[model samples]
Target chain A: MTGDGAPRTLFGKVWDAHTVDTRDDGAALLYIDRHLVHEVTSPQAFEGLRQSGRRVRRPGLTTATMDHNVPTGDRSLPMADDTSAAQMRALERNCAEFGIELHGMGSASQGIVHVIGPELGLTLPGSTIVCGDSHTATHGAFGALAMGIGTSEVEHVLATQALWLERPEEMLVRMDGSLGSSRAITPKDAILSVIREIGPAGARGAAIEYAGSAISEMSMEGRMTVCNMSIEAGARAGMVAPDEKTFAHVRDRPRTPRNIDALVESWRETLFTDAGAERDREHAIDVSRIAPQVSWGTDPGMTCDITEAIPTPAEFSRGDESRRAAAERALEYIGLEAGTPMEDVRPDRVFVGSCTNARLGDLREAAAAVRGRRVADGVRAMVVPGSQEVKRLAEAEGLDRDFVGAGFEWRESGCSMCLGMNEDVLGPGERCASTSNRNFEGRQGARGRTHLMSPVMAAAAAIAGHLVDVRGWELAEAV
Target chain B: MRGVATKYERDNIDTDVIIPGTYLKVHDHAELARHAMEGIDPDFHSRMEGRSILVAGRNFGCGSSREHAPIALAGCGVRAVLAPSFARIFYRNCVDGAYLLPVEVGQEAYESISDGDELEVDMAARRVRNLTRGEEHEIAPVPEIISGIIEAGGLFRYRVPE
Candidate 1:
């Protein structure tokens, strides 16, 4: 709330800071500061260069890691799966051949591509970043216009440090009021609830800036969780302006300016759009109304409060008939029925990791939810930390013990179970409550049904053997 | 091309569904194309032998910024994708890669174009001629700049004019 529209938003300030030139087409030729790469998408771009006989143009702006296909548990062993092994080796060979820095297995920095960027301070406020991974939007938490690029575009960026981007229509989604204690709302819940209210395409072609009292109060990690899933709602990206929390998180990390006053001043100047700034669309939500949300169908927008029932296709608006059909197909595939209470939807497995919700805070929340409560009998539960550093921190805080004690497999850091590239995958026909981004059919593994939920909700589901209201349990103790 | 259109109508047909994230690791465009739509429709690769265009509802290519999406479609011989809308990244990726041409038509256009309709796409004129219905519908042509990219055979080749 900057008084009478004098308030600058993070989006405006950051966009202005990074804009190199406005083309005749009204698109921006923005310079990217940091470019993250992973095994899955970088190989082709590198091969394209090899065929053309060109070297990586700017290795300084780029960094690479292997996450999408690396086995979660046995880093020492050769990848057990041929596809995973080949992808990992290809990234290693590509990075080596191109002279790009790579964080391989057993490295402290090795983890999900999105997790490592911010942790290493490579993703900074008022900067543009791109990766070949969709969750590249996760970096927008620092008020950067971070986005995912295609393999061809990755080569373009590798050759030229800048990208041609059409400026997206801007939207502001402001939240007010402290979340009610009984709501058990996390940033995951908040984002899911917002997506549920606004259909999947509600923010299409928009660069959404989240603001207001409640958003401002969240930690940098919480803000990251919110921005990470913005793409799920069909928005190009979501951002929260860099504030004291952002400054505090980045100050001690590598690459950030060591000077306190100068950093503060720079961040303050980067806050751009005023509260009343012109926007294509503006929405306001009361934080108190949100609860721990769970996706009832495939898309993130097909979400509801855990206490609610699966929506029948007939209940959908006329415009949503196709979506209703898709939902019906997804429900049928997931072995769930409409009109069943969402809380009654039991999961055979539980996963708590992804670029969307695998931060240290998410781990702590899951640990809290499972603390002193054993996982339901026959339920397969796993807690995969997002980054190596996140794993180390969790171990130092004894969070691993909480998860292990609750009968959950404490695994190494990677994008395990998020997009079944690695060894950690659900069995055929197994249904899981996951803290990942998408719940598309067989996304976790072939014939494995995924139910997207917050980490806390996943933990609650694991303990109860069903989708349960996380708020029903005492949560403060875990936090 | 002569059979009735086997329409697969769905909204938000994301790149992930068209080409899952895991297949991104494979560099061979042809091999990757074989797995296109494996998760969604297991026989998509085989079924799309000679399809000229894919008709769908809103927000096609909605997830992930993988260019493999357009490459996969192109390799599968799909010349055009006509949808009500498209995700910005996927749309740009398709254009930049010079693979698949994305045409934005109205919702009514999708409704009228039934499955198995023999169709011909004209990129220069930006129209889909519904041969079955003897009808013509205009679509948003690829921008001039993007048309140049396609003419040059993808972005890499386009950049090196020589």
Candidate 2:
């Protein structure tokens, strides 16, 4: 905060206070309040620490889990994939060696690191968090200044609990209008809509705070879903100003700061941007006509409304040769012809688990979508909960039964089929409706074409065995 | 820092291209190095051949927060990477891990130097000499703090208890 009584951006207040050392070149060393680690990016960092004989300087500040490579089914059985087993084993070994708490297989706390953080209240309004995984930006939902750090920076945080960061340019994304009459609009759609308007590099080198009525009315899970993909827009992080809803959502969590909960609450009240804070850029999205989004191209930004048609290369007005070439290639890879209706676009698989959409709320929405319908034949459909707790809660409510009875494989929790690390993957040349972030080539599997949609949309696709508009479509068909 | 350059012209060359996720399972540094830039250039390892310097377009390291991109670059014998701009995390990783020197040169320099051009970099002076072209290009700034970290030989050595 400036001493002269100037209004500060929410990012400014948190960032300025965390600046421990500022260099002449404007690079700042900011202290990390919390560090989250996952399997893939940590092994090399731990190795570097071992060579240096340095213990984690603040063990209490760091937490570890195995998400990206762990299996989401039948945990009692040994992992069939040898390399994945080894990666998970490496995380367990590194965490045990370093005295950091790990929530590994079968642990109640074990889940996607992003899911577990807010549930445990570790992600607070005024904190700064860093994780080796890019989706760590999800924690920014509670107004925390969270950003992804590379493994080397991971090691730096472990050694000193401080990371060198340059302050990012600030952008305000005001989701102006409501989804209007479309009650089916999900946060996944809202975010996909944002990405569509502003391409992948839209918010690069910036910090984004999502505002407007749509954001305010969104649930914590919805906010999580939105912030989880801020990295997809190439933003350093995305946040929502913590309001009463955020306060209520985080109030009684196991890790909510009990001692400082009140003090923190008071401090959080000051974290919102003032009326006249300077915003480097602002984009107002009038979402009245926005529908549940689906990406047809190779990237998240190449998207259209569910009612829209698959765009031809000519639809891309951008004059860049490389971008046009990339779009044309994506259409070829996805096997979607130009000007085809997005409706009834067939898929070989439907996946509903990832940090982006595997939460309980997502499950409930999906369960409602396929309550009494069986998956269409020849379409492989599966449901892997985001966390063990989500799975347990869903099972307690028999949401798992609704899915299993509907011919969906109700599995355990982890990042399954999201990045296609383990056995869960799409077959060659197969198309899938996925509720995961990122639609890059082979993201779901080798040579697999992915269509990014909401969990409910994925469920609808699985039941219909094609891209069917869930909008106004009857949930159950007559016998 | 000086070496002949192995050039890649595209922008947003992500880590997935640096070393694909499939090869990430293999731990051996040399093995990883073998696959570095294979996504973009299958013969990257053969092409680099210990050239020790890399020249590329803007946002050289873009997606996925993996230091393996730089680690694989280093393991393949790259000493310095010159780019007009770089993804933030990748830039920090270059300095923190002591993987390679990241020199921020101008776009003119990026377009001027071709593959196999020998180059000399003087960070203190903020310029690069294209020995092959017998010309010098003024680089944009490398953060003073970053230079300090590089001089101290990476983060681990930089913070050694005095």
Which candidate comes out best when scored by TM-score?
Answer: 1
Error of 2 at A230 (Å): 1.1
Worst 10 residues of 1 chain A by lDDT: A1-10
lDDT of 1 by residue, A32-113 (tens): 7888988877777787788878777789889998788777886677667897788788888888888889988768889999
Clashing residue pairs in candidate 2 are: none
Candidate 1 lDDT for residue A269: 65
- For model 2, state the Cα shift of residue B140 in Å: 3.0
Candidate 1's displacement at residue A136, Å, is: 1.3
Per-candidate iRMSD: 2.0, 2.1
C-alpha lDDT values of all predictions: 0.80, 0.83
TM-score of chain A of 2: 0.97
DockQ per candidate: 0.58, 0.46
Regions more than 4 Å wrong, model 2: A180-183, A475-479, B1-9, B50-58, B80-84, B103-138, B159-162
How much of the true contact map at the interface does candidate 1 reproduce, as a fraction? 0.55
CA deviation > 4 Å runs, candidate 1: A1-9, A181-183, A258-261, A476-479, B1-6, B141-148, B157-162
Best by DockQ: 1
